[model samples]
Target: MANIKEHLLNTLEELATEDLKMFQWHLTNNVEDDKHIPKSRLEKADRHDTVDNMVQKYGQIGAVEITLDILKKMNNNQLAEELRTKVKNN
Candidate 1:
């Protein structure tokens, strides 16, 4: 089974640049308080950097949950389901 970080990276790697930006936008605006990621941090972050920051702030499972939630909110249900399935299978 892949580690949570690898799963996250793989999931993010699937995104196009614009979609990735939208994903980051949701991460910045949708979450509150401790779950919030600073715009400055996300401003220049790539997929790996974003995953690193998420893991740092929320740990592994928390990051995955947040990713799943944001993906769903973005109406990217296909990716969200893929992530859920991967996590479940692992």
Candidate 2:
């Protein structure tokens, strides 16, 4: 079987430098462009509260995991670029 780490590294290497920049931007931007929607519970709690911690805690297959899975299956480089941009950089 192909190693996932090697595949990720290869994918990273193949992406254009600017695409990488955009990817990073999407990861950090989170709710940019008035797109920050809240969950049912959070909406009842606080409008300005960040959902990051909550998601990291309770979300099964957190955003990063979901994004990686989607990236692996969709095989759409553009979608992968968008999804990766929002992921927290290690």
| TM-scores, each model vs. reference | 0.94, 0.35
Q: Residue 20 of model 2: what lDDT?
A: 43
lDDT on C-alpha atoms for all candidate structures: 0.92, 0.41
Best by TM-score: 1
Which regions of candidate 2 are displaced past 4 Å?
Answer: 31-90
* Candidate with best lDDT: 1
Cα lDDT of model 1 by residue, 1-90, tens digit: 798899999999999999999999988888986689999999999999999989998899999999999998888899999998898888
What's the lDDT for candidate 2?
A: 0.41
RMSD of 1: 0.9
What's each prediction's clash count? 0, 5
